[model samples]
Target: MEISRSLAISSWIAMAIVLSIAPAGCFYLPGVAPADFQKKDPLMVKVNKLTSIKTQLPYSYYSLPYCKPTTIIDSAENLGEVLRGDRIENSPYVFEMREPEMCHIVCKITLNEKEVKDLKEKIEDEYRVNMILDNLPLVVPIKRLDQESSTFYQHGFYVGAKDQYSESKDAKYFINNHLSFLVKYHKDVEMDLARIVGFEVKPFSVKHDYEGEWMEGRTRLTTCDPHAKQTVLSSDSPQEVEDKKDIIFTYDIEFQESDVKWASRWDTYLLMNDDQIHWFSIVNSVMIVLFLSGMVAMIMLRTLYRDISKYNQLETQEEAQEETGWKLVHGDVFRPPANSDLLCVYVGTGVQFFGMLLVTMVFAVLGFLSPSNRGGLMTAMLLLWVFMGIFAGYSSSRLYKMFKGSEWKKITLRTAFVFPATVFVIFFVLNALIWRQKSSGAVPFTTMFALVLLWFCISVPLVFVGSYIGFKKPALEDPVKTNKIPRQIPEQAWYMNPIFSILIGGILPFGAVFIELFFILTSIWLNQFYYIFGFLFLVFIILIVTCAEITIVLCYFQLCSEDYLWWWRSYMTSGSSALYLFLYATFYFFTKLEITKPVSGILYFGYMFIASYAFFVLTGTIGFYACFWFTRLIYSSVKID
Candidate 1:
């Protein structure tokens, strides 16, 4: 007995050390970084550029009635030599409209000097020089140009000189002129015909422009066409040609602040200055302290005080009736629970799930499957659930047999499917709703399907095998036999009522998680990102302690009340954590979240219900088994009449 107590104390100390070090190793070690901390390549440069341009561009450019050209010059001398011309090759780009009336257009342009000359020759052959030159003014309909890009152009052009163009609100016209030049000459002109002039025609609100290495080589330009928009008549006399160029052109340009707003000063302040780690650490530490204190209290009361008191009581009772406290209820020791068959099956399945949950959480805390692994936690849990089915079948079958249940086959079949089926139905329904909403946070369809398959194939078979083994083995022999007739029930005090006791058992665990629950709620409902799995692992440990402590404490009182039918009560006492979880979630929805509609509320509670149900089962099993073992150990050692 002394050795067992020493071992338990040592194991608890070791577990505490391990839990502390595990998270420190994963998240806060001096030099070690977790695997999830690995960095990826930076975002593509083109996307960054587009994001910058959008922020800088003026609001007026998004409107219509583009600015008009001052003059049109066609003199060969005014026409600059075809500057550096190159084609922007094909690349993926997305042009989305920010407003209903706006359109976004994106396309690649190829330019060549040789092709422009060929088109000029063809136009010359078709008509006289003077006629062609005169007609050129009216040939390009501005209305047609507007219609061409209207549906495709959502947001206005993302120009560099935003300040210069702020007053005119004509930036879109300048952009359209550039686009028109590219469209007309692109097909007929060779790459050399178009030279990317200085800043006037720059890349627009393009996020990424990986215009390949070859494209970068085309950034060279020689000679300029200051008045390329003008048309000069090729008269027989040079004097006539010189007179035709009467208009002077100015490149009216302006600059404005870039539209892309960098992270706000306040946002940066919030991100870098917030003490998130400290908050989580403090909350987790408090919860752990509370859990440990509660557990220590329960251990003292139940194991230490109860043992001493019971021993004293037994000595006194022997002087009178020669019966022990436990022996007094020996007749009702093995009386079956109400709905014994169903109870056995559910408890058995719950036990299997409980073991799987423990193993999985331990592995997670140990870093085999951390948050960095994305869906690894769920994957591990699913696999363990399937593999642990046998425990469920065996426990359910054995318990049912001990209850003298005759429907072994029925019990086995129900045991195999009941819990899994409930979980599956809940999971599938939630998955369907998640799919409809296209929530990336929800489990994927394939993963859900795989879970179903695992339950039906792996878990069901193992359950059957376990049931067979359980059936083959003799039923567990109870330490005491149940009497055929019930004992006269004694009236319980107000505090001894099952409801009151169950409610009391929930307070400690709820207190441990209420603060943690806020952060969890934020992550789930507000679309916030939270990857503090290390902290969560610690909280899990605290939850276990709180549940066990609460259960043991309540169990002691029930035993003192001489209510020996503590099996389900022990389970439900700790299981009350689920109710607290639900209540906390409800509070989060009303006070912490901005959700307004009934649908969102339903979805929130619906999903929470499933999660809380699982949690209830897990915590209940922990309490039930802990108290069960403690009871068995203490009773086995006592002297009975």
Candidate 2:
């Protein structure tokens, strides 16, 4: 116990030291807190990527032949931003606090044949141009009467729509060159200070006839003039994207003082998806699972107590010989199973994932990872996983030592590389697919190099150090001694068969969290924000409980069936949830998603496979430890000689 406590303390200190040395680019001091602004403060607008639900792809905003600055400098991004395909950069659009503009020309560009082709393809994919103003993403509010909420937002507006008003042999595409911006702000009652709270835009397609060539910030439009006692209205015949044709980009800005305070500005955006969650159904389902698990636990404990008492009150040694069932397998139970090294490796890897997820979720719940901090969640997950390699090494090496294995280094290497290697291979293939599509979703070579560097330099060294410490310590004593010859197992019931039993055991644990899984998947595939970490944390705890309980129940039954080979079986019993999870992902792709492109389909399954595999490791580790504890406690309580 003293050694274990010391190792844990050492791990914490090492983690803290490394984190303090890491960059703080992914965080804001007070994310979601108000940033005060003086009157007429210039608000620099930025452009993100062009997103499309149809293709499930995000292309750089400048990827299409759109208006651009003289030199398009890339925004500084963290590792997570690169991985998530975020390409943020400065745009020509600008605004000021408590100021408005009408019929402002951004740029005029002629569309060549190739540029026209690209634009049409984007429209075919139903792409929306995403823009950012004052760190707030521009959203187009869509009113709905289908649910309790009257309005939800579409993240960005479509570049153009085709063949809606006319049915020509060749689709006539109209581009949305006219943007009507609505900037919402909160004004301080005591002073003239104000803070930009919301940025929304209503996109339109307007064909403008200007008098002369205009330069940005200096030119005004005569077709839709602000001084003519009127402002621009979208033309009945909007600008059409055509080959060898010129198009003009224009915008209008309007400022409105909102009643909402600066601090509560994010309330509206968070509430946009309130209709997405069905609370009563989720709560009701979770309660049923909890109640059933409790009842099973109560009955199992009572039965175990009665059985132990009866077996212990033996009159003589002859009575002990006649005893059968779980007691009969006592000698073999403590014996190391075949291929115990593999089990240790898996359990250790699981420990690493478990630690990373636990810490990441805790931070998210405490508001350290707000949506305001773009890419913060993914960054935290990656960094936490890398730093947690120490725990993985320690756990696997310690387990290998207990299994009486001599090759501690081999086990440590497997723990450090095997799972990550598999994930990387899958990710690489999917990234290759995205690269072929020429989308921003493809991770850059430099970012990939950084990932490799982190794994090798920081994570590997930590693992080696942890393994050396863990392997040097004394191995834990087993509760029961193994016999020279293992006990023969009796014929087990069909339900106790490893394959059937493991799969069945997974059902309950999966049932505990499948509802929550829907929301998580929606957030990822639908490109929406998921900030309900508090509820998510609760579901995480519930999942842990379900996995532990189900595995313990199954282990007890296996032992009772006179089967002592419970090592691998116990891990798989809970880990089978991964299979179900992957299947559900496939189902979602077919039923919920409309991904037609083959590459997009491949990318979806590829990433989901990685996610499911991680889940397998995490839940599998939970079950293994729970079963280990149960066996130790039960065997220790019994009168074994």
Candidate 3:
């Protein structure tokens, strides 16, 4: 069969374009800034020190009072006057967007009439009252009232509880009132002082906020008794009364800003490193370059040596008498094996599938579709599958025809059904298991039905069309006539065995992904987030290179060993990467996963099998096509008589 040079050149050009453009698109797209570009800002609030103090009260307690230097108020004279048990009235200035109005602080000394009379007499005699209020509960208004409407209700007052978890009925009442205020008066009031204040007053605890408004209506207090010469501080201020009225307590308030940025939304460590992309790209590029260089060097050296030796031995009698190298095996090239017609069809379908895959990847590398296009890769693959079904049916039919098989319809049916049927059965079983587990990750029933419908309705028709086109075309004439008698089988070495080579071919590719598999497994099982795009891309490229090189190497060895049954072997040899992938996944489950249960295990393996199948097909195609080209090139160059 003649290969169209134009077609080959066009395919090459397409591949080049895809490779150049796809990665560029990823870089040029508009998206979230790279991690390196993001800058962290300082935190908003700062608390210098906090201390816990044991009070005379029943429970353990703590108090935290912070200070900020400011020149807003010139003197402490007004504050001192208010502290002397006098009625002080001041207009409240609006703080934190709340309307400030006239508020009165009436210092009330609590005492019975008799106690007050005695205290007054004592104070008059001493000229100073040594007794001072201690352990007073401070009540601060967190809201304001305007006209007939209550613009905002008092959120709550912070009261020092006996202990961190200690609950007072009064505190609960205040909290309930605060909840009511938050619900009724303001749509935006969502702060919880009781919850936050405990943390605030804890010794060595730090507090920071972006907005200063969170600190409104919050205060800390210290109490002193002149007679005892003792200073006591409480998270809650001592309660004071004046003329049978409750007085609002005041404390020194301070404010400051802090330096720290809020944490990022995507906290995965793998994603934060910007250098990973460049590193991965460089590694993959190096691997590819090394692979290509080695392959080319091997080809050129082997070809040159063989050609020179053949030229020198042109007139040798032994060389002339011996059957031509590749020509001797031509008789078995297209020969059909007994009871293997179905195998032939499936193998042929695989070949067609492989061809399409190669073309698609070539295009992908040239930039037709890359990660930048979102679902472009999937869409491209799906389209290629549909279009390539024609080749699949055609190749199988033509091969079956060459085998002198009369059951063309059977061959066609098998060609159409084999791959799709295998896929459907695997998928359906997996889906059933997923359904039983009630896993949301499972494909929906409708999607499963749609897939079946697509297989029967869409894929079948395409296969028929492909088969028709294939049958109408002339059969590919074998380069040499087939012999009626089968050739004798030759002895093989241990390393020359197909199984060994195929197994070996799978190793390098799997080795490339072993490290990557750890991260992917962690993401899947531990629910850890991973965004190692650069590393993934690098591993992907390495996998492809390893598969291709290993397959080519194995094909060469098999050829040298006089194993001409490379058609299927080439596919399976590279396809072995899937087995390695499966084994890796299995290992990951046992060693890396914490999952328990038969269903989860089954489900994991089931999905893994499907992925493995796809991967097998992809790598199998790469190996087969590469081997096919190498075989054709070597055979065509050799002298055949």
Best by lDDT: 2
For residues 581-624, write the lDDT of model 3, one tens digit per residue: 89888987777664455666776787688778877776776676
For candidate 3, give the lDDT. 0.46
How many pairs of residues collide in each model?
Answer: 40, 0, 19
Tell me the lDDT of model 3 at 545.
Answer: 70
TM-score of each: 0.56, 0.94, 0.52
Q: Is candidate 1 or candidate 3 better by TM-score?
A: 1
| Cα RMSD (angstroms) for every candidate in the order listed | 20.0, 2.7, 21.7
Model 1: per-residue Cα lDDT over 370-471, one tens digit each:
432323455456556666777777777877888888777899889877777786787567556644543322454555565568678777887777777777
In Å, residue 146's CA in model 1 sits off its true spot by: 48
Per-residue alpha-carbon lDDT of model 2 for 88-108, expressed as tens digits? 999888667777888877888
Q: If ranked by TM-score, best first, what sequence of candidates would result?
A: 2, 1, 3
- After superposition, the stretches of candidate 2 with alpha carbons farther than 4 Å from their true spots are 1-33, 147-149, 165-169, 212-223, 228-231, 275-278
lDDT (Cα atoms) of all candidates against the true structure: 0.49, 0.82, 0.46
